[model samples]
Target: MSQLTIVGLGPGPRQQLTAEADAILQSGQPLYLRTQVHPLTADLPAFTSFDSLYEESADFADVYNGIVTRVLATLADGPVVYAVPGHPMVGEQTVAKLIPQAKAAGHTVRVVPGVSALEALYASLAIDPSAGLLILDALTVTPETLQPTLPTIILQVYLPRIAADLKLTLLERYPDDHAVTMVQAAGDPDVERSETGPISQIDRLGWIDHLTSLYVPPTDETVEYEPDGESIDGMVRLVDTVAYLRSPEGCPWDQEQTHKSLTRYVLEEAYEVVTAIEGDSPDAIEDELGDLLLQVVLQSQIAKEAGEFDIDSVAARQAAKLIRRHPHVFGDQVADDSETVLVQWEEIKATERAAQARVLDGVALALPSLVRADKIQRRAARVGFDWPDVQGIWDKVAEEVTEVQAAITSGSKPAIQDELGDLLFAVVNVARYLNVEPEEALRQATMKFTERFHRMEAAAKAAGQDLSAITLAEWDRFWNAAKGR
Candidate 1:
C-alpha cells in the first residue's frame, strides 16, 4: 500500500515545527498543504511547488472533500506529504476526513504531529486542556449545539465574517456576558492574544483567522447520578432505563409486572401523592412523588416487555399532548384567559379522542365507575349537557325518588329496581351539581349509617331484653332511643 503522510506545520514557523514533521515535509514524494491560509504555511522556509490546491473551493466542506480526493489520488502514485496547520490531530478537518478514508481505501495513513494551537494557547496562558477542553470549527458549530464544556478550544476561526456568525449563534445559548479569549498565530513573531468579555464584543476584535482558536473555561456545576447502570458517560435515554428494567438482565419484580397488575397501585400512589402536594408538604410530596414515579416506571417497564410502549413513549406522547392542546405555548394560537385555555383544551382533547374512536371519552374504563362518571358528567356539563344548578338537580333527584317510592308501592321487583337505579343516577347528578365527589360523599354517608346502626344495637343490648324476643312496641322504643327518633 502507498504511504499517506499527514504533517502538522505547527502554529507558526519552521523553528516551532518538530523534526519528525520536517522530515515528512521534505520526503518529496508529493506535498499537499491542507490549506495555505495559516501564518505558518506562508512562513514555510521553502515553497513546496506541488502543495494541495484548496483556495478555489466555495466552502470548507468542498475544500476538505477535495483534499481527501487528492490524498487518495496521490497515494496511488506512491508516498505523499499532507500538511495541515496546527497539530495533525487537533481540529484539522482534512486530516479527520483523510485518515479514515485512506486506510479504508487500502492506503497506509501516517500522522506526523507538530505544535497545535491548543499547546501554544495553554503555554501562553499557563493553563491545561487536560483540565477539560473542547474544540470546534468556527464555521460550522452554533452556540446551541455546544455542550457546556471547560477549556474549550474553538479552532478554524478563518475570517471576520465567520466569527461574527459564530458570535451571534453563541449568544442564543450562552449569556452575552460569557468571556472569550482569542489566540492568533500562537508562537509566531507576530503572535497575539486578545481577552474580551461579552461574546458580542469578541467579534469586534476580528483579527481571528485559520490560525486562531478560542479558550473557554468550564461553565457550571455538574450533577452526578447513580452510576451502577450502563455507561455513565453518555446522555442516557429514559427508554434505556426502561429497557434495563424490563430486560432479562434487569430487576426481577419489575420484569414480572403487567399492565393489569399495576393499575390499582398506579391509582393509589397517584392519589396519595397528589394529596401530599395539596396538603402543602413539599417534603412529603417528594417521597410520595418517587413512589408515584415508580408506578410510571414500572408500568413503562411492563409495556416495554410487552412490546407496546416505554417511558419515552409515555413522556413524548404527553409532551406532544401539552404542546398540541395548549397551542399557545408551541404555536401561534392565542388563549388570553383560563376560560379560553380550557375551551381550547377541551376542543383539542375531543378531537384527539375522536381520532381514537372515542370523542366523549373522558376517563379510562379502568378508573372507578363513580370517578369516571363524575369526569364524564363534568366534561359534558362544560359543553352544556347539565342541570342549571344544584336546585334543578335536586328537583330531578326528588322526582326520581317519588317514582322509586311509587314503584315500591306497586310491589314489582323489576320496576322498583329500575326506578331505584334512576333515583341513584339522579342523586349523582345532584352531587355533581353541588361540586361534590359522589363516591366520597356516599362513602361518608354509608359510614355514618353503620355507626348509627351500631349505636341502636348497643342501646338494645343494654336493655337486657334480647332484641329477637322483644315485643314490637318495646323494640320500637329502643330503636327510637338509640336513634333519637
Candidate 2:
C-alpha cells in the first residue's frame, strides 16, 4: 500500500520539537509542511509548503480541502511526509480530512505526535490541566457554543479580526473586565510572550499570528452547571443520579415518586421556566429549563421501573412522529407557508387516528379553556366548518353578549353562567383569528392593571389621602394619571 506520514512540528522552534518528529523531518522522503510561516519550518530540510494555497483560496475550509486534494494526488506517485504546526490531531482540520480519505483509499497513514500548544499553554500559565480544561478552535466557536464552567484554551487565534470576534463571544458569558491570558509561541523561551489583561482589550495587545492562543480562566461567581466534565458527561451523570434516587437505599421522598404523582412537579417546573423567560435573564432561563428537563427524566425513569417504556423509546417515538408529521421538511412534500404546513400536519395526525370516530378526537379535554377553544376552532376550520370572514366572528360575539345580558335580566343563575361561558369562548375565537394566545394576553393585561392600581394607591398615600375616602371622580382622575405615567 502507498504510505502517508503525518507529523507534528511542535509549538515553536527546534528546541521544542520532539526527536521522533525531528528525525521524520530530516528523512529524505518528499516533504510537505502545512505552512512555512512557523519558526521551526525554516530549520527543517528542503520541503514544499501549502502556505501559498492560503493566499489563493477564499477561506480556511477551501485551503484545507486543497491541501488534502494535493496530498492525495502526490501519494499516487510515492510515499510523502506531511508536517503541520502543533500536534496533528489537535485542531488540525486538514489532517482530520486526510486520514479518513487515505484509509478509505487503502493508504497506510501514520501520525507522529509532538508537543501541542496545550502543553506550552499549561507551562506558561503554571496551571494543572488535569482538573478540567476545554480546548476549542477559534474559527468555529461562538458564545452560544461555549461551556463557560471550565477553564478554556482557544487555539489558532491567528488574526486581529478573529481575536475581536472571540472577545465579543466571550463577553456574552464573561464580564468585560474578566481577565484572560494570551500565550504566543509557547515553549520557545526567546520568542514566547504571555500577556494578561481584561478580555475587552485582547485585540489591542497586537501581533496575533499562527502561534497565538488565548487562555480564559473560569469566571468567578458563575452559577451555571459544574464542568459538564466532558460532552456526554452531564447526560451520564444525570442518568446515574436519577437511577440512584429511585434505588431502594436512596432518598425516601424520591423512592415514593410515581409517574402519576410527579405530574404536579412537571407542571410547576414548566411554569417556572415560563416565568424565567418572562424575566428576560438567559442564565435564569437556562437553569429553570434544566429543571423542567429533570421532570421528564424522572418520569421516564419511573416508567422504565414499571416496565412500560424507557427514555430511548420515548425519544424514538417523538423523533419518528416529528419526521412523519413534517413531510415538507423530511420528505418530498411542498408546503409554501406555515398555514399550509399546519394543514398538512393535521392531515398526518388524522391519518394516524383513522380508527377514531370523531373529528375532534385528539383534542385534550384537560387543556386550559382558552387553549382548548382555540384547538376546537382549528380542527373545525380544517373541515371547512369555520365562519366566512371577520364579520361573522364579530356577529357571533355580539350574539353571545346579548344572550349573556338576557340571562342576567332573567335572573336565572345557571343560564347566566352558561351564557357567560359562551361569551368567553367567542372571545377566545376572536383571539384565535387574530393569531394571539388568549390566556397569555389576558394574564399580561391583568398584570398591567395590577401595576397601575398599585401606582395610584402610592400616589394617593404620597398626597396624604386614603384611597378608601376618595370619591369615584377622584379615583378616576388618579387612574388616568397612572395610565399617563
Candidate 3:
C-alpha cells in the first residue's frame, strides 16, 4: 500500500515553515513541490528526488490527476512527500484533489499542516478567522459569489492571468474605486499587502503569481455568496444600496434626482411590473418589480438626503397606515365579504379624517376631474345625498351635452367651458350609478379614441394630405375607416 504525505510550506521563509512539515521534507523520500514560486522554497530541505508536475500543467485538474497516477504507481511499495504552498488545508486545490484520489487508490493520505496565508493575512489585516473569514480561489469564482457576513480573502491567485477576471467580477458588487489589497507572500519578510486601486487595474495576465490574493473590505454591496450559513433579507440590502446611491459618495445623477423627476418612471415601471406578472414570467416580473422598487428606494433616498425621510420611515408609514386601515385584519372589527370590507375601509378612513376635520375631503384636486368627481359623489352619497335613480343623472348629462353644443354654435368659449364642466360632472354621476370608476372608464375611453385618432392621422399623412387642408368630410371618412365607424 502507498502512503502520501501532503506538506504545507508556510507562506514564505523557512523560519515560519512548520517543524512537522520540515521533518517530512528532510526525510529521504520522493518529493513533489506543487509550485517553486514560494520565497522560502530555496531553504526547504533537500529531498530524495524532486518533481514539479503540478505547476507545468495548464489544466490544474490534469496536473492533480497526473500526480495521483504517478504517486499510486510509485506507492505500490513505499511512501512519498508532496509539498504544497501554505497550509495543506487552506485554499490549496492540489491537496483537495489529492485526498480523494489517494483514498480511491487505497493509499493512506496524511496532511502535514503549516502556517497558511490566512495566518499572515489575519495578522497583517488584524482579523480572526472565527470572527468572519472566507477563503476562496480567485481563478474559479467571482466576487459576486462571495459572502460578506465577515471578512473574506480569496486565495490561489496562482497568476496575474486570472486577475482581470476577478476584477471584473468584483466590480459588479463594489464601487469602481473600492480599495482592495493585493496580498503577496504573507507572513514572510517579503510579504506585501498593497492597498491597490480599483479592481479594474488588476491584470489576469500580468505579474501575479501563486502567492497573490485580494482583500475586499466590508461593504453594503449585497453579497450573494454566503460561505457561512446566514439569512440575508433582500429588501434590507436593496434599501441599503439605495441609501448609498443617494449618498454624497454615490452617483451624482441619482443624488440630484427628485421624486417628481422620477414620477413617470415610477408609473412606467409599475405598469411594466404588472404586465410582466400578467405575462406569467416570474423572471420578467422579478426584474420589472425590482425596477419598480428602485423608484421607491430612490425616492426615499432622495428624501433622506434632503432631510425629509429614508426607507425606514417610508416602510413604517405605510405599515402603520396599513395596520390602521386593516381593522378586519388586526382589530376586533368584522367584515363578511368584499363589499363589507370596502364599506368598512371607507368608513374608517373618513372617521380618521373627520377626527381632524371633515368636508367633501374624500378626493383631492390632483386626481383627474372625472375620478375626483366620482369619488366626491360616492363619499357624499354615503351621507345620504345622491340621485334617486340613474335616469336623473342621464338627464343631467344630456342637458350638459346640449348646452355645450349650443355654446359651440353660439361661438362663446366661456359658455362652452361651463357646459363642458357640467357634462363631465353629470357623466361622473351616471358612472357611479353603473358601479364603474368614472376615472378608469374615462381613461380607457380616452385611450381608445387616441388609438383610432392616431390611425386617422397616419392614414391622412400616407395620402400626402395636410390635416389643415383636409375638409371635415374627408377627415370623417378617414376617422370612420380607421375606427370602423
Judge candidate 1 at residue 446 and give its lDDT. Answer: 72
- TM-score of predicted model 1? 0.42
State the number of backbone clashes in model 3.
6
Error of 2 at 176 (Å): 41
* True lDDT of residue 224, candidate 2: 39
Q: Which ten residues in a row have the lowest lDDT in candidate 3?
A: 223-232
Instruction: Summarize candidate 3's per-residue lDDT along 182-228 as a digit string, tens digits.
Output: 77766767656455666667663355766777877777764344423
Please rank every candidate by TM-score, starting with the best. Answer: 2, 3, 1
Tens digit of lDDT per residue, candidate 1, span 164-224?
5566556544666777777777677666656657676766774765666666555663222
Over the full model, what C-alpha lDDT does candidate 1 score relative to the true structure? 0.70
* lDDT leaderboard ranking: 2, 3, 1
- Candidate No. with top TM-score: 2
Q: Model 1 Cα displacement at 316 (Å)?
A: 40
> What are the TM-scores, per candidate, against the unseen true structure?
0.42, 0.49, 0.46
Q: How many clashes show up in model 2?
A: 0
